[model samples]
Target: MANARKKKRADIPARDRILEAATRLFTQRPFDEISAEDIAREAGVAHGLTFHYFGSKAKLYEEISQAAADRLDRIHLQATLAGSAPEKLRSFLVAHMEEVHRRRVDYVFHSRGGGTAAIQDIWERSRSHGIRLVLGFYGVTAPSLELAVATRAWLGYFDELVLAWVQGQITNKAAIVEMAFRLFPVAVANAELLGEKNLPSV
Candidate 1:
């Protein structure tokens, strides 16, 4: 039995085994209901080993979410078509939505209410990075104050809108993207009119 256990242990890398088990569990169960011991049992590892590697259940979930986001980021960065801001942003958004649609489990897990501080950190960082990406694509090296404010507001709105689309609360994804497209100018106009307070961070 000892030799059998050792041989089985050698069959899978520790972190990957733990992550695979956790991913399966996360897909089936709510985050709060899951425990480290449950993940250890599912991974066929010693209960303490989950803590040894991940420190906490929250951290494990954060790592899983981050890994999935990294994969999608790689896909989104791949330039399928080189063109102006609209063309590039549209291609990027299409790729992003497709990746999120494919990884609906991770998308739902990351987006909804059951989020930790670690997850919130990821979202905050993503918001900043998204603004930078848009500014680069639009060739706006020195964005005005209104443009920055509007972009921030647009990102906040876009995240919620995409969440609704993912949850099937909104059926028209094209409309979601279409609205996003129209809102760029609207956000700017509102920022100009309302002194950067109208569309204030969704």
Candidate 2:
């Protein structure tokens, strides 16, 4: 049983290695430019193993994209929940900027594929989840349709700022954050409007 468990642990690394290689390739190059053979060569595994594990290049790309999205969501959720609303907003913005810097290649790939059906579906799912999370942070028990529209508008502004920053249109992170803060007075006003009984002082 010990030997079997050890072997199971051993196989995990190979699977992770494949995923890591695939992620690197997908982010660094266009999807059409990356092939299963390239992933297998980079992973130092047999070509057939790529198919054995991921079935196809498209599936592998989808899996890697989903993994990245899941990781970002987890980070955002944790940071938001671990602090007061103001701190949460600050942390979320910083975290998001850091993540965009770290994952620029992934961002480029998604942005460049804007009109692709697969990318559109992924964006829709991610956007829906993001909207729900933002509503939770605002502490709106029953947000009206107008509130939803406002939230989406605010989120779009934030996203555009981050994109601009990432693309070199904005030079300073602190300045960008400050601008975002100026535009996002809702974070402060929401605490009062929601009647959060024990709101922390910003």
What clash count goes with each model?
0, 0
Maximum-lDDT candidate: 1
Query: Which lDDT tens digits does candidate 1 get at residues 1-202?
Result: 9999979876998888999999888866667788898999999889988888999888899998777666666675675347877777777667767776766655676666567877877756765666766766756666667778778888678767887887789988888888877776676667666464433222
| TM-score of each model, in listed order | 0.77, 0.75
**After superposition, candidate 2 runs with Cα above 4 Å error:** 1-14, 112-116, 186-202
lDDT of every model, 2 decimals? 0.74, 0.71
RMSD of each: 4.9, 6.2
Query: How well does candidate 1 match the true structure, expressed as C-alpha RMSD?
Result: 4.9
Model 2: lowest-lDDT 10 consecutive positions: 193-202
